[model samples]
Target: MMVSYVLVMVIIIKGYGKRIGEYIDEECRREIEKKWERWEEKKRREEEEGVREEMELWREESRRRIGEMKERMEEGIRRRIREKIREKKEEIEKIEGRLELEEEEIGEIELEEEGIEEKLRI
Candidate 1:
C-alpha cells in the first residue's frame, strides 16, 4: 500500500509539473508576440518618415526646374518681340521713302502743265 501511494504521488507531481511548464510556455509566446508587434510598428514608422522626406525633396526639385523653364521661356518671348519691332520699323521707313519719291514726281508734272498752258495763251 505504501508503494501504491508513492506511485500515485509521483504521477500527480509529474502532472502538476507539466501544467506549470505549459503555462510558462504560453506566457513566453505572448511576450514574444508583443515584442514582434512593437518592432513592426517601429519599422513602419521609419518607412513612412523616409517616404515623406523623399517626396518633399522631389517636390522641391520639381519646383526649381519649373522656375528655370519659365525664365527661359520669358527670355525667348522677349527676344522674339524685339525682332518683330525692328522689322516693323524697317518696313515703315521703306514706305516713307517711296512716298517722298512719288510726291516729287507729281510736282514736276504740275509745273510742266502750267508752262504748256501759258505758251498756248500767248
Candidate 2:
C-alpha cells in the first residue's frame, strides 16, 4: 500500500512539474524585462543631464572668450590713442622749434640793416 501511494505521488508531480516550470520561466522573463526598462530609463536621464552640463560649460567658455576679446580690443585702442598723442606732441614741438629759428633769423637781419645804416651815416 505504501509503495502504491509513493507511486501515485510521483505520477502527480510529473504531471504538474512541466507546467510549473513554464510559469516560473515566464515570470522570471517578465521581471528581467522590467528591470531592463528601469535601467534604460535611468541611463537616458543620466545622458540628458550630462548634455545639459556640457551645454552650460560651452556657454561659460564662450562668455569668457568674448570677455577676453573685448578686453584685448580695449587695450589696443588705448595703446593707439597714446601713440597718437605722442605723435601730436612731437609735431607741436617741431613747429615751436621752427618758430624760434625763424625769430632768430629775423632778429639778425634787423641788426645787419641797422649796422649798414650807421655806416652810411658815418
Candidate 3:
C-alpha cells in the first residue's frame, strides 16, 4: 500500500510539473508575439514617414521648376516688347529724315520762283 501511494504521488507531481512547463511556454510565445507586433508597427511607421518625405521633396522640386519656367516666359515677353519698341523708334527716325529732305527741296523751289518774279517786274 505504501508503494502504491508513493507511485500515485509521483504521478501527480509529474503532471503538475508538465502543466507548469506548458504555461511557461505559452507565456513565452505571447511575449514573443507582442515583441514582433511592436517591431512591425515601428517598421510601418518608418516606411510611411519616408514616403511622406519623398513626396514633399518631389513637390518642392516641381514648384521650383514651375517658378523657373514662369520667369523665363516673362523675360522672353519683356524682350519681345523691347525689340518692338526699338523697331518702332527706328521707323519714326527714318520717316522724320525723309520729311526734312522734302522740306529743304520746297524751300529751294520757293526761292527760285521769287527770283524769276523779280526779273519779270524789272
lDDT of 2 at 110: 89
Candidate 2: residue pairs that collide: none
Model 3 agreement with the true structure over 3-55: per-residue lDDT tens digits: 99999999988989899889999999999999999999999999999999999
TM-score of each: 0.73, 0.71, 0.69
- Give a tens-digit lDDT track for model 1, residues 1-102: 999999999998898989988999999999999999999999999999999999999999999999999999999999999999999999999999998888
The best candidate by TM-score is 1
Give a tens-digit lDDT track for model 2, residues 1-122.
Answer: 99999999899889988998999999999999999999999999999999999999999999999999999999999999999999999999999999999999999998999999999999
Q: lDDT of candidate 3?
A: 0.96
Give the lowest summed-lDDT range of ten residues in model 1.
105-114
| CA shift of 36, model 2, Å | 1.3
Q: Which ten residues in a row have the lowest lDDT in candidate 2?
A: 12-21
lDDT score, candidate 2 = 0.97
lDDT of 3 at 95: 93
Tally clashes: model 3.
0
What lDDT score is found at residue 8 in candidate 2?
94
Q: Taking the candidates one at a time, how many backbone clashes does each contain?
A: 0, 0, 0
Off by over 4 Å in 3: 1-26, 112-122
Worst 10 residues of 3 by lDDT: 12-21
